[model samples]
Target: MWVLTSQFSRNLTSHSSLLSYLPDVKVGKTTDTGKFWDPHFDIHFCYKPNMKWSVLFVLGVLSWGNTLATMVPKEATFYQLDCPKEGTLQYFMLKRSGQAMMVDNTYKVMEQNITIHSNGSIIFHSLKVEFEGTHLCVMNHPDNSIHGHEVKLRVRPLPPTDLWGAVYESMFVTGLIAALVIAFIFALGCFVYKKQWRPRPEDEKPVMSGYENPAMNPSDDGESGSTNM
Candidate 1:
């Protein structure tokens, strides 16, 4: 078992936003092929309005092994992640407080190779993730202790396979090109409409329907009639 913990302070001159400071903690464990040494972690966190003694004690109890702690109004949760490779296991977590409370849309981007084994395994490298939601935990949370939702743990490293590039190319770049093509088609249609709409001798302009006005109507007076006669 390996564990790491940290703490920091943030200025609280005004409550313009949910004032919060957090200690990031990391934990790791390994297991054998037997029944239960499987790699997993169970963590607990307590949130206080300020650095209060009671709050720290509460946080400590939850971390130690008190199952009852799980019943507390928890804003952060512990999760178990799989470690396929014995190398560096990079991990991250997000905890929401004050303004974020829910998850809506979440996305993850990986720039390099990622491989998956037949056993439902996953690997990723150079990964970027974006999540949006009401009461989202990472950037926007809505609770006083933490915003709303929380990422208790995240472990990252290079993608495990080589197929990652193809996946991203299909989803992002290909989609963008498709959208542009559609817009171009619409522009062409507008141009055709303008070209066909200009006043034409066929459809829009008035027609000279009454015998071309005779070019010069014969006077009703007898003078013209007599000359022609």
Candidate 2:
């Protein structure tokens, strides 16, 4: 059970191949392109090596049908495999479930061999069990006719999410949210502690107006004073 994934550029005008060897067993197989193939991203799975059972599935599509054939690039051609040296192939299986599926399936693949044959085909061991999915299978000598080149395989599964996206919903608000909250609180406190119209004796005293009071006239003041004496 071995699964291998690869990626390439769409603009090269000619198809290309690569060969790399991975000695580590973690995070799955990774093949970096010695050559850069830009503007094109492709994904496929290789299921079951050397066995009659092999299949390739195109990813990121909603449904599989005739309509998909039309979507495939006319300029793009199928990729072949290549190996550096001759060696016995080793394999492993990995099971993965995604947002598109109800459960995960075990995928089988091998780490890069110290020595593998040129133009070899590889496959995922368990992909056949999952008829509802798409994957890639390796070729016996995909690159023999093509010659020495570097190929990159992208096989690691990404994190999945439910209805809500990964980072779209934010509890964090900036600028206006903080400003409005502070303003509302300040206004509310101001109203509660506001000053009233209550006045002291000085506050009640009247300033000069146009009319004069007859009680305080000079003649009236004199008459009052004479009577008092």
Candidate 3:
């Protein structure tokens, strides 16, 4: 009878040990994979196919949108817009105000000069304080597809006494002085050439006396005496 009691106690302890090793199973919910869900936590963990690719696609779109924005310099003489040259494209520049105006590439719009370069870059010349606003660069492809790039231009007035202003003034003065010096030197050289090449009258020939004239035949006297002897 003691052996039977000890055997029962050993069997009970082995069963308890086995149960402790097993995971705690809840009766709240079961997933499609036959896994039991915890009741306390409301989180649902599932594998989404192509999740990495979806995240990468979202980030690529964000980066592509950022690439379409441009910033113009505040104190620049010109602003350049580099467009993609993948297809036959027509370029258009638009000024955005209360109403959008198509920027003309003519002298009629002298203040806002536009130039299309050999490359696919559009140049906006003579940036002015009035041009401080939003601008759009539109490219129309052969397939009727349109792509737009936006620009925010702000042109600040250059100070009269700034370092760059001083430098420009000094350069202008130096250039003016150099030009004047070159002009003066060229004029002096032209004057000297004219004077040196001027036509002058020839000097008059000196008249010789009869004694100084070899053609008078002074040796004829000695020849006549020898003949007389």
Candidate 4:
């Protein structure tokens, strides 16, 4: 694999150099068999010509993988990016080379919300959800060599809120809970006090009507009845 890679590298360099001089060599000409053809000569006679497309495919895959890796947080040196809540102010600094500083490189971002400074810094006055995407910062030199960096801005949507909004929401919920707890405690205390200390009804006392009572009259009545008999 290494041998093939080295050979392909040399061939690619040679092909690039040849393209400058040979105008007739069409770079993207392909055969009916879906194989890439060499413009200078017959592809079958060329060295490992059948493997060109495969090698190109491998290089493309590697490049794509590198791009994805760079987009991740740990490897974001290639770009300036921020994930801020929507409508918040945000700032970003672009990485620049000394060579870029020495040359007259024009710097600009495409978004209207972004302000590009002379010192390779940018600011977002208020971030928006629509700003979440890859943005380009182009630096064009006097020699017409265009250098560009991608800025990946991600705008997080604001969290949902009720009528209280976010700042007062926690306090409102806490106060409501406290009030409910206090009410429950008061009701429980009243119930316990009623059960433990409240007075109960006493048993009714007997009425004292003297001789007309049943016990008092019973003996006298029986005795009188015997005497009469």
Candidate 5:
């Protein structure tokens, strides 16, 4: 029987905001026809906390097995396991002694914060600071099929809230100042335009009285008035 083991690590620092980490581990086994076996799996984790923190562990199966067609086809069966906690999975608190403990349906050391999903996958959650050290996952089959994987978890400290808050407040104040400056400039431009505005000139009309008409000469009117006098 050939044994396969694969190891991988997923960093939770990438998701610091959410304070959640999900490790992706895949395990599978194949058997010939007329072979019956039960598979067993276990996960091991170690955590030391600088301060008080909480964590959760969840377990589920992704795919059971696939059938192979041949002269004698092998049958594949899928099984689902329940989560460690009965109802809502609670977080396991890690104390100052650098020890992590969880209270749940299962009394196992690392099984406390576990939750089993419909699909078989294990999820571990805790504060970034509280997660440290090496984690191991073991899968065993009755037919001597054993697979193992190693995961190293590392978490970085979150940025100080006061610093981030100050940055946000500064940015908001800067934006407000910029908006006020823009509005003032706009109002000044409108005021200047109104002050500099001038009215357009209208067309002039010619005087057209009986004597002032162009057809009646001013000298003829003067001679007639002199002759009448």
Candidate 6:
């Protein structure tokens, strides 16, 4: 039995296809001396090279998918101001979980025009270009834990008031270019027609009556000759 098991092991490793035709073998009941009464052989199993690589490839794909799912971007708060006049005051609430928190003094204030209150409210006085950027609000909780939040700011200029200015603002560059191309083609067509098809002074001729010239009165001279004859 030991020799048979060794032979199976060697055959399994050398030719993995042996597993397909291998059958289950059960040894006979053991006797008092711990020896089997019947002859049986044990089968050994081994993995093929292609099967091993396929398992590794599947594991790699699963790991990569999990990494991508974890790397998704988080959304942040944003604020926009439309043509805010100078010296105008603006307010924003940075409250979280319905609790009022105080700002951490360790964080430096980058914008002089902005102020943070103990109630998680941010205020911008005399809003200017310097105030239009990212602001960080760091706070200390009751448990002495520190937390930070980011706020984005944007400023836009006033809209145009006149008709042409409004139309220009509403139209994109491609639309403007197309309009100019059409006008240029119309102007070119008008120029070509005037230069090539319009009548010239040298090509014009005067219209004369046939009876006013001697060469055109041949019938009258023939009539007088007949009368003389």
Q: TM-score winner among the candidates?
A: 3
CA lDDT, every model vs. true structure: 0.38, 0.36, 0.57, 0.50, 0.39, 0.48
lDDT of 1 by residue, 119-168 (tens): 21233323223212121122222232322222322323334365788698
Query: What's the candidate order when arranged by decreasing TM-score?
Result: 3, 6, 4, 5, 1, 2
* Candidate that would win on lDDT: 3
lDDT of 5 by residue, 108-183 (tens): 2343233323222333422234344454333333455544334344444555669989899999999999999999
lDDT rank order: 3, 4, 6, 5, 1, 2
Backbone clash pairs for candidate 4 read none
Candidate 6 CA-lDDT value:
0.48
Residue by residue across 7-41, what tens digits does model 2's lDDT show?
Answer: 54542324333322222222433336322222233
lDDT of 5 at 107: 24
The window of 10 residues in a row where model 4 has the poorest summed lDDT is 96-105
Estimate, for each residue in 99-154, the C-alpha lDDT of model 6 and write its tens digit. Answer: 23233221223333334445555544434443445554554556665555555654
Ten-residue stretch with the least lDDT total in model 3: 1-10
Error of 2 at 54 (Å): 48
Return the lDDT, model 3, position 135.
64
